[model samples]
Target: MSEILRLDAVSRHFSGLKALSGVTLRIDKGEVLGLIGPNGAGKTTLVNAVSGVTPASSGKITFMGRDITGIKTYQAARLGLARTFQIVQPFAEFTALDNVAAAALFSQPGESLKSAREEARAHLAFVGLEAQAGQSAATLTLAMRKRLELAKALAMKPKLLFLDEVNAGLNSAEVERATQLIHQLAASGITIVMIEHLMKVVLNVCTRIAVLHNGVLIADGPPREIIKNPAVVDAYLGHQYAQRNAAHG
Candidate 1:
């Protein structure tokens, strides 16, 4: 597969604390890569760095063969890099359609409100939120809000999408729905990097897995191999997961 993004020894520091340390990675086009880790393992920081929410202190980030280490968040969005936040924060007062329309307007230059709303409708429909389009965002259920976040990201027309804990607070059925959406997105040929805690969801949707622990990448491989990796098991997956996987295997 062709490379879509590359991070060469990337590091990010906040007040002398290394949130990310020499994290080098690469993403291929149309890949569904799961970024898994325990809490505070720098998974989100790495996504922030690549998406330009937080600029890296050192090393390079290349997207589509061009360096974007210093690109701003808006610039990154315009360049077809979009991400959904772990905390789904939509404009409470805005209608669901308007919330997505705002994203479309912001990411694409010269997009009129009318044109943006038209496009937002399509994106909302894609995420199964068409019926709630006219409803106030604050009135939506958590599951609907999560789908709204996805609709908003889709409005940006991203080539590479970062999904940060998209299934964190979901129930089993909701997670299944979200997983199906992710499968659809991947099947549509978008390169995806998902930071997820649920091993089942990660294993189900991701083609490969990358594990982080205390700001370092300890494992990278196919799910079957990663689940058996000693360092990954120690750092995040734990013995129980391994045993359960073995039982299931």
Candidate 2:
């Protein structure tokens, strides 16, 4: 597995406050990398910088072996990088199929509306939303909306997909479904970088986990090792779990 995405000494600041501090990480081809942290820990900021939404203060981002530092958000998509937002951004009035079609158009050149629609249908089916193809985006439930977000991102034919908290606010079953979809994506050779809060989902789906704290990388390893890292326990996994572990010892 070759490295598909790499960030070197990346940092982001807002109004002189650091959002990400010298964060460095890599996502290899055909791997699912989980990014986990408490709120304000710079998980999303690091993602935004990589996806070109926010410019890094100082660093380099390489995608598919090309330097994509400071690349435009839209242009990144053209280069086989696509992302789903933490907040689902559907064209409210469009049908689910239309929403996906819009993304299919963003793929490679020589895509027609009809051709995009056909590809969009496949994406919708992949997300288990084929039945909702004709339904208005605003009419879908929250879980379905998140699925739609995944479908739309997939429609772009991305090689590297950044999923931003797609499991947030879903029930257990919904999370399981999302996990399965992600598993399918990885099986099909789409490298995934997921930002998720749910530890169980991360453990189940991620090949490797990266922990961020105070705008920096604190830990990165296999799921079980990351969970056991003392720094991770101190930084993000509150005292309750740690205290319980100590008591049992």
Candidate 3:
């Protein structure tokens, strides 16, 4: 597959702290790459920088071969880059369908409201939220809201999607459902950068895993290889699993 996104020594700083430091990586076309790290590992910062939610302090970001390092969120969305937040924030007063339709109409060129709503319903169905389409966003449960977020992002028809903690507060069943949707999207040829704390979800859905700690990328490899790496376990997965593995050996 062709390369779709590249972060060359990207860094983001606030005051004296570096949220992301020289994190270099690339996403090939049609791969689901999971970003795993501790709570403050700069995972979100890295995604923010890449998706134009926040500008990088240093380095280059090339998306589809265009330098888009510090482009604003709206500009990036127009370029087919979209992301879901850790908090699923929809337009509370709008119906779920309208929320998604607004996204489709806003980012996609020449999509009329009527057409957008039709497209929105399809995306909502894809995420298993079609039945709740007419409900107000605030009326939806956490799981439904999360699905709505995914639907809204899909409405944008993004080429590269950043899913930031999509399974944050989900039950096992909801996570499984989210995993399935992620797999479907990946299989459908979307490049995804997923930041997740749920290892089960990551292991199940990611093609490869990237690790970050203290604003630095410590490792990048296939999930199996990543799980076995002592450094990765130490920094993120903890030494308990490693100790058990060693004891068994």
Model 2: per-residue Cα lDDT over 219-240, one tens digit each: 9999878877889998998778
Model 1: lDDT equals 0.95
Candidate 3 global lDDT: 0.91
* Candidate with maximal lDDT: 1
Question: Which regions of candidate 1 are displaced past 4 Å?
Answer: none
| lDDT of candidate 3 over 132-185, digit per residue (tens) | 989999999999999999999999989999999999898989988999999999
160: Cα error in model 1, Å: 0.2
Indicate the worst ten consecutive residues by lDDT in candidate 1.
Answer: 212-221
lDDT of residue 43 for candidate 2: 87
Candidates, ranked, TM-score:
1, 3, 2
Clashing pairs in 2: none
Q: Which candidate ranks first by TM-score, i.e. highest?
A: 1
Report the number of backbone clashes for model 1: 0
Looking at model 1, the pairs that clash are none
